[model samples]
Target: EDQVTQSPEALRLQEGESSSLNCSYTVSGLRGLFWYRQDPGKGPEFLFTLYSAGEEKEKERLKATLTKKESFLHITAPKPEDSATYLCAVQAVRVQGAQKLVFGQGTRLTINP
Candidate 1:
């Protein structure tokens, strides 16, 4: 079965604090590892697309990396606006050449100023 799981259902960080969220997944054949940030009541915004182990992607204050069985979303020097639900989704090779992504429950993060 293909599934994705996230840890620490929620996290609280002070302005400038750093932390990491974990995402574990099991899939038949991994086509891509995706990271997204979602604000309340809004759709997820794409962050990274990792296709192989040891690969890393980064934005202004966010970094994402993937491995064979897991992925990590690392936030550095976070700001108040950076607070959101960090969602990790996995896309695998599916029938009919469709890439179906299974998303994790997400790690809700809060940053206080």
Candidate 2:
């Protein structure tokens, strides 16, 4: 079965603290891995797309990396504004090539100033 699971359901960090969130997945054929930041009561905002192992992408304080079975979102020196639910989603290769995202339960991060 293809699925994604994220660890440490919630994290609380002081401003300027750093942490890493884990997204573990099991997929038949991984087409792509995606990361998003979602605020409460709002939709997700795209952060990065990772294809193939060892691929990494970054935006400001957030860095995303991919592996065969899992992906990681590393938060470096996060500020209060960087606090949000980090989402991990995966797209699987399909026969018709129509890709759909399977999203994991996001990790809620709070950066306290």
Candidate 3:
């Protein structure tokens, strides 16, 4: 079965501290890997879409990279506003001409001043 696992479930950091969140996945016929950031009581906001290995994307203080088996969300100099739950999802090709997303539990990051 295809699944995604995120490590360190939660992280608490002082403002300006940098960290990396891990998203490991295994799937058949991978179509794309997705990254999202979710705030409390709100839907996830799309961050990146990785179509192949060796692909990387960046937005402000956040950078996402993908390899064959896993993806990483690297946060640099995060501020209190950066606190959120980071989610990883995978889209795999299906036999029925459809695609489904498998999501990781998410890593909750708290940045305090």
Candidate 4:
């Protein structure tokens, strides 16, 4: 069985406020973890890929870190334009060719000036 859930359906933040996004998951076997950012009506843009528990990736004002049971996406000094839906996509190579991706509900973030 594999499942993923994200918290704080939405978030409001000051332009520079820092916060962390959480994704909790359960799976039969670990394959890979993925993070993506999506605006209102566009396809997701890949952010990071975590292959193991102790791995991490970062870019600009965002950072993604992963563990065995969960992953966190941290935002630092965000700006108004950073407001968007953050999505977490996962995949299990163990499943072979059954499904290519699994997606979370997404966390909507708003940065206020």
Candidate 5:
């Protein structure tokens, strides 16, 4: 069974504080891992996609890294605008021509000034 787990269900940080969020997953025949940021009442915005261990991607104040069993989102000098729910998802090889995406519960991050 493929599964994803995010740690620290919720986090609070002062403006400019730096932190890292974790996403651990287990899947057979891995295809790709993805990252997203979702604001309140809005759909998730795509952040990055990782296909192999040691792969990484970055955008603005956020950087994502992937390993065999987990991924990390590192935020540097976060601002209030960065407050949102960060999501992690994985895609496994198709089973019966149907692709499935398994997502973690997400880490709700709050940045205060």
Candidate 6:
């Protein structure tokens, strides 16, 4: 079974604080791993897509790295506006030509000024 688990179900940080969130996953025939940020009452916004180990992507204050079994989202000097639920999802190799996405519960991050 394919599954994703994100650590530190919730986090609180002061403005300018830096931290890393973890996303661990187990899957068969991996295809790609994805990251997203979702604000309250809003849909998730795409962040990164990693296809293989050693792959990385960055945007603004966030950087995402992927490995065979897990991925990390590193935030540097986060601001209050960065507060949101960060999501991790994975797509396994197509089954009967159909692709499915498995998602983690997400890490809810709160940044305070």
Q: Each model's TM-score, in the order given?
A: 0.95, 0.96, 0.96, 0.94, 0.96, 0.97
Q: Please report, in order, the local distance difference test score of every candidate based on alpha carbons.
A: 0.93, 0.92, 0.94, 0.89, 0.95, 0.96
Clashing pairs counted in every model: 0, 0, 0, 0, 0, 0
Clashing pairs in 5: none
- Candidate 2: residue pairs that collide: none
Task: Put the candidates in lDDT order, highest first.
Answer: 6, 5, 3, 1, 2, 4
> What is residue 102's positional error in candidate 1, in angstroms?
0.5
Candidate 2 ranges with C-alpha deviation above 4 Å: none
Candidate 6 lowest-lDDT run of ten: 93-102
User: On residues 14-101, what C-alpha lDDT tens digit does candidate 2 reach at each position?
Assistant: 9988989999999989989999889989999999999899999988888999989889999999899988999999999899956889
The residue pairs found clashing in candidate 3 are none
**Candidate 3 residues 24-106, lDDT tens each?**
99999789999999999999999999989999999999999999999999999999999999999999978785577889999
- The sequence of per-residue lDDT tens digits that candidate 4 reaches over residues 1-113 is 57889987899999999999999888767678889999998989998989899898989999999999999999999999999999886787663567566888999999999
Worst ten-residue run, lDDT, model 4?
92-101
Q: Which of the two candidates, 1 or 5, achieves a greater lDDT against the reference?
A: 5
Worst 10-residue lDDT window, candidate 1: 92-101
The collision pairs in model 1 are none
Off by over 4 Å in 5: none
User: Model 5, residue 45: what's the lDDT?
Assistant: 95
Instruction: Give me candidate 3's TM-score against the actual structure.
Output: 0.96
46: Cα error in model 3, Å: 0.8
Ranking of models by TM-score:
6, 2, 5, 3, 1, 4
